[model samples]
Target: MSSSIWSSLPFVAIWSVGYWAVHVPHLLFLSLRNTIKPLRPVPQWSYRLSMGTAVLRAVFRYIGALRYQQPLQLTPGRSGDRFVRIAPPADANLFRGVFGAPSAMAKPAPVSAVWSPAPVVAPSSSHPSDGRRRKVVIYAAGGAFVTGFDPEMSSRFTSALVTSEHFGATNLLFVQYRLATRADPFPGGVLDLFTAYQHVLGLGVAPADIVLIGDSAGGNLVLALLRRRAGLLALGRNNSRSGGQDRALAHQPVRHHGRAGSVLGVDAYRPKGKALTQEEEGYISPMDHPFRLETPLYIEAGGAEGLLESIVTFAGQMADVKGNRVQFHITEDMPHDFFVAYPFIGAKKESCEALKRAKLFLEG
Candidate 1:
């Protein structure tokens, strides 16, 4: 609720409480009805979640918070691993990693002297993956790009992943990429992810040992980064003249609530108020131009998700790629990002099963 209000008007949060208080009972009633007569199999609390999320979506889209970069507290929770802040990769490593060294590379972002330091979630110290430990999960948090590290869902979901012996991840790096609302969209998040990946490499973790994990919009960025790493899409300065790598860096959404929630999400892919062109839409959607890639992937989607059909089709394309390992899982009864609410009341067994599947996929 306060997330949508401007910092200057802190009173709005106080005053808005009365309005929410009045509606609580009504919302609960609706939530109850949803559970009794669910449109599809979902957790009992999911009804309340949907109601709350609808309001949250409106708050972010209507309150205009999406236009600015709000403060972020990158807490690592009780995992005993702190978030490690590292300097952005030098021009040589980032540029040369995705594409051959350029004669001159543009600074994608302002230098540290001019901007705040790069913030990344610290890899697990207790189970550091530096050769001795092995694999690490680079977690990209889902908040529709408006919210960073959604306190509600991310904590529950991530905690389960890290604690589970099934997942067997000793280290996890949660990337604190800039949000679209901060006036950084498209390549901004990907660029930060690339730096995080390289930073982990510098830590002596093997590339094969790294597992990219994300949900919702964060999941999309993970998918894009996978392609970027595989040399399908380059994440660098947008150069319209060059194709594949150079020209490719230029974004195309080429491209969202329940009904309205979907709309709010689409806007996050571009600058505020700016509409997406056809090619730009394509850039954000990996399914649009599915191609061959050797990078292994695990894709999960709800059978009830509007994007389920498309997600399945995309995974099929990836599976067809020669020697590419793909594990696709569908929880037919849950909604999109249902795992975020994880092991909650109604979805406990289902959610745990999903995580177990992910662990097996990664290990195998």
Candidate 2:
């Protein structure tokens, strides 16, 4: 009886191992398929593979199956190219936190080439302020810490603004920043942005005269600067023709002013709380900063972005503040970074309208 039991134990163990081996991949595949079902007309095979990887990553994420709590290391390839070793962070909720770890600790291999500054559109000699026909405007493009900053991505708005009937002859200083990846983390790009802002500020333009315009991530930075008084937030209260007042009201939902209003007022319109701890929220959030409301600011974001909560929250906070002057343009049905896809299906007529509104808000 003892011998039979021993033999049976081994057989059962083997069978169990085999059963899991056979089912695990299928389970992972099914989970991936179900997750991506909403994203159909499921492209070609390569696209499917990429999407499948993204989906599987999300699956591993939802169940908390990952072993590592932070991003994996990257290593240099044969040709001095950097390659990430572990799978990219899954697009799960925890993915951002995991990927948000400092790049120094993560030890991603360095790329040989450094990102050079985008060609600075020099202020034309013909600026009206300088008795010339040109105006110098700063353009900050937005991405949710991950993607974008390509020339094509910025061209739609920049080209139009530089050549528009309203904003024509305006020279653009397009500020391009780094992105968060397995290599780069949060605040890496944001720091670069401040450097760019300071560089522009050093160019002798008064903070009040500089028209700062940014969308999405760039918008967040603009508001951050405004909140920090790194520049200003031009409130549209002065001009009847300006759209800033309307946008500010629409961006923030009004609540009764009360005892809680001080804590939860316009300052709450920023994207700092909820998912973040009090300390983390305080450190990274623009709302936590002080402001002077010096420059005319134009900020916009898509209605469908997850960050809309923070955007509206920060906007509300700004609105509640006694002297902060900020304006917001919330475009409907627009997803995060929708402007990057200009001339694509997502760039609806409303984008044009938003640009027009932005131009008027800035030029007014």
Candidate 3:
């Protein structure tokens, strides 16, 4: 029988405690192993930071499985990138949140990225104040499509991109979609994002000036939205969009496919141990079909990433498409969505460098 997220609360609580108790040994092993790996040396705290994120992620997915109409505290303020109610433009969709982490805002000209109580309005296709052609980044946050990573993490990502002078982005429109659990399946969530792409077009932002950006599963969604004709930049799943983790086998999160199955949001399209329905299998292995992605792409993964091989394959295939301009970036020793986890692990220097490289991609 199906259960709403409300019914899953006790499990979330118990599992969090239980998982952490046993996760300590694996955490210690990873820390020691990571030390000898060829990846850049950051603070050792990153091991805990990554594991804690994984635990919180599992819990968030459980919470996100509730029906959309449920009485839950999932407003944008509480949502952490999980929700932003998008009604008709005339109804004035309510979106409220400040952009950028305090650390991000501390940089030069962070004001360019900060806003609150901002409505989803028809933005000028160019900077009205300066008459510069607008470059809009349609940002899709990554979280296995159940929950978002966190507000601060997303804000920091936005801050990094927006503050980049090289990228020259005038405005960024974050996409809102019914998550996998709420939408109840694959294309359902993708459909909502397709509408978001249309929304940007309606705002008079030309397809050429628009850039699509996503991390993790969100990256997969960006690739799907490419049929809409926007420039694409993503931290892709190995064939999975922002898969959160790789196939761990007995291991935890060893592989990320934009790919979640044994755990997390996979419960939506795939029930445990059951054969995937046609729709579910299609989503699980998207590259199985051919897509003519004419939009320019900047695909990336961490050198130490579990999703590395798949990401490489996906990017390679995209490059094979006639006239596809693809740029693949590999950040040495980084983990999946390292930029999102960097701040937590005190990797500010690396994060800034990443932003600079992303600027080059956007500018190209």
Candidate 4:
């Protein structure tokens, strides 16, 4: 071998070791988590190919954390572009427990940043009621339910959504949800999502008019929320079909923390299931909760993501159910969270195509 090739052997060896160091544990952890067969089986080749993208994402995330370290902090007393709108008090309990440190680290309140287009108002037709024309997008960040929200990341995504042709200049709420670990567990993140959804509804935006967009874990939350919504709607429909007696019973008023659970009936989406595995994870399957309704859902996934299997299966499940206006796109060769990184990276063609599809979905 050449002298240079021999000299570079140490570097190559170290790189290979580091690559496996990062990937092996992650893949193994996923394996352990899926001892009870995942909703969709992830093939071996797919896992191997996705590791490259995962490594790239990790490198970018670590570098970006150091670069945009200040904006990533959720400290208090900050105003202007740095501040976040807090969540309501009713949902504050969702962050309690052992893994609550992440939530408490923030301003002792649930908060999120809002983005709206500047210098232009969306068309009047966008808003369904009150003659005030506006479009609302409630977005959640994806970090495998372990990493908390990043301000800079949310800002980039919200910007892409707002500037898109289909969504012109619109109102966007970037929700910050609690992350789960072994200490925290599941459903806490899902509960935070429910709170965020309710917060958006409280902001006077109709549920039908609001669009839910999330990526990866955030996408999972969107699916879960849609499932819950579907369940509630189906329950309501079934009740109505069964002689309208239930609607009268629902009106009889049951108190929940001092307010009726629902004016009409029980909202199945209100986080009833106590166990995380049964309530949240179980409903993630589209076969169980295919969001078969008129809600306009736009889901974008990278063709090269580790989560692609589950995302594709969930999307396919929804597709198979019929009655859903769902626009699903897999940006070929892209990795997870490509939308946020597109500006920093130079995959303008693929990224732009994904965003274009998003715009078309919204416009349609």
After superposition on all CA atoms, what RMSD does each candidate show versus the true structure?
8.0, 14.7, 11.8, 14.6
| Candidate 3 local Cα displacement, residue 97, angstroms | 35
Candidate 4's C-alpha runs over 4 A off are 1-55, 58-82, 89-111, 114-132, 235-279, 284-291, 307-309
lDDT of 4 at 167: 49
Query: Judged by TM-score relative to the true structure, which candidate is superior, 2 or 3?
Result: 3
Report lDDT per candidate. Answer: 0.53, 0.42, 0.49, 0.49
TM-score per candidate, chains pooled? 0.69, 0.48, 0.63, 0.58
RMSD of 3: 11.8
Q: Considering lDDT, which of the candidate structures 1 and 4 is the better prediction for this target?
A: 1
Task: Give the poorly placed runs of model 3, Cα more than 4 Å off.
Answer: 1-84, 88-120, 123-132, 150-153, 228-263, 270-284
Q: How well is each residue in 1-364 modelled by candidate 3, as lDDT tens digits?
A: 1364347879756866676677666556665666553431444335545555455444444444332222222355533443344432231111111111121111111001111113234556553434446566666666565554344345545646554664556666555444555234555445455555556556555666666667776776666555322212222212222111100000011233554432555555333434545433434444543356555566657776666777777767767878766677777766666655565544456656655566675455
Q: After superposition, how far is residue 103 of candidate 4 from its true place, in Å?
A: 20
For TM-score, the strongest prediction is 1
Model 3, residue 153: distance off in Å is 6.0
The model with the greater TM-score, 1 or 3, is: 1
Number of the top lDDT candidate: 1
lDDT for model 2, please: 0.42
- Error (Å) of candidate 1 at residue 115 is 23
Q: Put down candidate 1 lDDT per residue, 1-364, tens digits, no spaces.
A: 2355555465566656655675566556656566664541345436645555444444544444334334454444442335455566665544443222231121244211000112223367664433355556666666665556543245445655554665666655566776664244565666676677667666655566667777777776776676665552344433321121100110001113223544544565554554545433434666656644435566777666666766777778767777767778787656566655454324556656776787666555
- Candidate 2 segments whose C-alpha is farther than 4 A from its true place: 1-134, 166-169, 181-186, 201-209, 228-283, 287-292, 346-348
- After superposition, candidate 1 runs with Cα above 4 Å error: 1-22, 31-70, 74-81, 96-131, 150-157, 232-259, 271-282, 343-348
Q: How accurate locally is residue 147 in candidate 3, as Cα lDDT from 0 to 100?
A: 58
